[model samples]
Target: MAHIVILGAGIGGMPMAYEMRALARAEDKITVISNNPKFHFVPSNPWVAVDWRKRDDIEIEIAPVLAKKKIDFIGVGAKRLHPEKNQVELDDGRTVDYDYLVIATGPKLAFDEIEGLGPKGHTQSICHVDHAVEAEKGWQDFVKNPGHVVVGAVQGASCYGPAYEYAMIMDTDLRKRKIRDKVPMTFVTAEPYIGHLGLGGVGDSKGLLESVMRDRHIKWICNAKTTKVEAGKMYVTEHNEDGTPKKEHVLDFKFSMMLPAFKGIDAVFGIEGLTNPRGFILIDPQQRNPKFKNIYAVGVCVAIPPVEATPVPTGAPKTGYMIESMVTATAHNIRDELDGKQPSTKATWNAVCLADFGDTGACFVALPQIPPRNVNWFSQGKWVHLAKIAFEKYFMRKMKAGTSEPLFEKMVMNALGIMKLKDK
Candidate 1:
């Protein structure tokens, strides 16, 4: 029996385990190795920071769900990956041998890159459930004595949606509390513009986001490189288009949340020919490492180059739907290989995301995720917020049921002509 091992059990890995279980032969053993037993829906972390969601609302005990599907689960996490021997060393002094390995360990939050940034420092974060919970307490403390607020992504950061979401969510919550006037908000970002979003602006995203921020009375500084952050203050250098320093600002803030750069987890870092210099797995179009054919990677663990050079460094985002496509392709490719056939499936890598703003939200669809796409659309409305809520509920249910893609989800994607894999 061919054993397929899936590493990590967060947004990308859990679905990958389910999809692999569905596609593999009945006798093929599928196992998932995760650092934690609970799976937290990462997109809802912004809500958790603002009290819209509790810890239990977004977390699922993944072991029970995987057990129902007849899949093995190990929560000891990965200590080291011996790709040369097709063996994984676990933290609990155990080893797993697999014919195929899917690495979806997600990104290691690089908070230490900036001094006084991240949950352990001056700013708070919504990148992880525990971090979001801590931010909730910080939020509580801040609202008691409202002052300046700072929110955005820093240099070398990739994921920008949550930064935008948290900023707007906090704005909405403060407005509801009638203390918005007491809080002056400033958005500091690494993107050259308000809505670059690392894909070079998806269809008027810049215009729409800038307009919304203006409506909310939120000021912004783009192409900003945060030099340092002390308690209650932030130092930033705003860069010009020519890469020159346009201005420097030292702003005081009562509360701050800045998304940091992401890198591959330490388990597989520094592996020659397997990962880029940043520790992200190097994958071809099929999501398989060129040097290690039996190894595949998806989600933030995969290396994607920036769309274009910017005054301040920024990388492209690998959103939820795009990661799902990668997972689907990886499973199918492994199944083909197990059947003594060459792997051929390739993911569409489409980008479809809903960025909630508490009261309203923005939705974008980039057909290929990169520039020069067939369909690039971004729009905002209250219905988008409602749709995000519905998605969270449906996705959680689907995970609990161990279903890769629910019938309704498939139907909706089909109706929209959104294909997860390229037609062969």
Candidate 2:
């Protein structure tokens, strides 16, 4: 029986394991490796940071859940990947062999690329539950002594939705606490314009997001390159469209949470023919590595070029719907290989996202994540906030049940009238 090993147990990995299990031959073996023993819903991290959701509410013990599905669980994590030998070295000095490997370990937050960034330094983060927990402590202290707030993603960062979500959520929280008047918030981003979202501004996203920020009294600086962060101060260099430095600004803040750039994890970093210069796994349209045919990738760890270049560099985002497509495609391709057929399935790479602002939220849909799509839609309402919360609960339930159903395709896309959009 062929053995398939999946690295990571996050948003992409967990679903991959379940889907693989459902599709693989009963005699085939499936194993999931993760550094963290528990799986936390990453999208809820912003809520966690603001005390809207607690850690326990989102985190699920991984081992038991995988056990119910009859999949082996390894929490020791991966130290290195020896693709040539088809083996993975574990952190605890063990090794696991696999007939096929799926790298879904997600991105390694590149906070050190900038001076005094990240939780270890002057700023806070919500990339992980642990980071969110720590940020919550800072949030508590900040509410008591409100001051200037800095929130946005840095250069080369791929994920932009969370940065926007947190900014709006924090605004909502402050308003609820009746302390918003005391906080001056600024959004600093590498995108050429507001709501570029690393996909070249979806469906009037630029105008809509800018209007929302204005209404919320949040100021913004685009094409911003964050150079350094010191205690209570952040250094930024705004850039012109020609990539020339335009202005230098020194902003002071009591609380800051800047999304850092992401790169491939250490286990697969610098692996020849497997990753790009930034360490993201290089995958063909089928989600299979071109050089290493037996290896595939999904999620944020997969390499995707920027939709368009701006003054400051930014990477394209692999949103939840896009990643789900990748996972489904990867599973089908692997199954096809096992059946002695050439891989044929391809992920649509569509982009659908819900950005919650606590009380109200926005939803956007791109037929394909890249620009020049058939359908580009964006809308906002209180219903989106409710939908996002429902999505969270439904996703968490799906994980616990170990179901391999495609949540995005079956629910989100359908609800958004994707069928009608596609017919256009």
Candidate 3:
């Protein structure tokens, strides 16, 4: 019986374990390794940061949930990955052997790349639930004495949805508190345009997002490179389309949340033929490492080139729908190998995003995440906000139930009338 070990217990890893369990032979062992004992819904982190949702509301004890599926759970995080030896060294000085390893460990937040960034430094973050909880403290303090607010993503950052969500949510929250007029907000992004979103602006996304920001009276600066952040002050260099600096600005803020760039976890970084220069796992079409065939990867840890180059570097986002497709394909491919069949399944890599602006939200769909896609759609409405809330609840329920069903594939695609976009 083959032992398949999955690393990290976040969105990508949890679903991967469940899907693998459903596909693998009964005797095949499936183990999930995570540093954190509990699985927190990352999408809800923005809400948590604003006190709209609490930590306990989005967190699920991982051990208990995996136990119900008869999967082994290891809370000790990986200290190092020895792909050649087919073993993972744990922080507790133990090692686990695996016939096949799936590296779903999400990206390491590269806050240190910039001076005085991250929660410990100057700006707040909602990347993790803990960060969000800490950011909530800052949010509370800010509401009491509101002033200039800064929010956006930094250079080389991949995930842009949450940055947009948080900015709008904060706006909505401040309005509710009747303190919005006192808080002048500015959105600073690495993207070439307001709605680039690292996918070259999905179907009028540029216009739509810019319009929304205007309606909310939120100002934005694109092609912005955040050089340094100090307490209540940010240093920014705006770039021209030719990648030359156009202007410099020093802005002061009472509160701020900036998304940092992501890199592969230390465990897998700098491994030859395994990861890119930025430490993102290098995988072929099948989501399996070209050199380490037994190793597979999904989610933000995987390397995907930028949809288009801008003055300031930006990375493509691996949205939930794309990650779900990757997980499904990886599971099927591994099953194929066990049965002495060649791997054939490939992830569609579609992008479907819901950016909640608290009371109202926007949704974007790209059939193929890459440029010149088959379908590109974007829309905004209060219904999108309600849909996002329903999605959060449904996802949390799915995780608790230990089901292998693909949430986006089964529900989102059908609801969007784009089930045909998925590969059968």
Report the C-alpha displacement of residue 137, candidate 2, in angstroms: 0.6
TM-score for each of the candidates: 0.96, 0.98, 0.98
- In model 1, what are the clashing residue pairs, if there are any? none
- Give a tens-digit lDDT track for model 1, residues 1-424: 9999999998889999999999999999999999999999999999999899999999999899999999999998899999999999999889999999999999999999999999889999999999999999999989999999999999999999999999999999999999999999999999999999988999899999999999999999999999999999999999999989999999999999999999888899999999998999999888999999999998999998998999899999988888888899999999999999988999887777789999999877787788799888787888779878888898888899999773233523742453232222
Task: Flag clash pairs in model 3.
Answer: none
Q: List the residue pairs that clash in candidate 2.
A: none
lDDT of each: 0.91, 0.93, 0.93
Compute the lDDT of residue 403 as modeled in candidate 2: 95
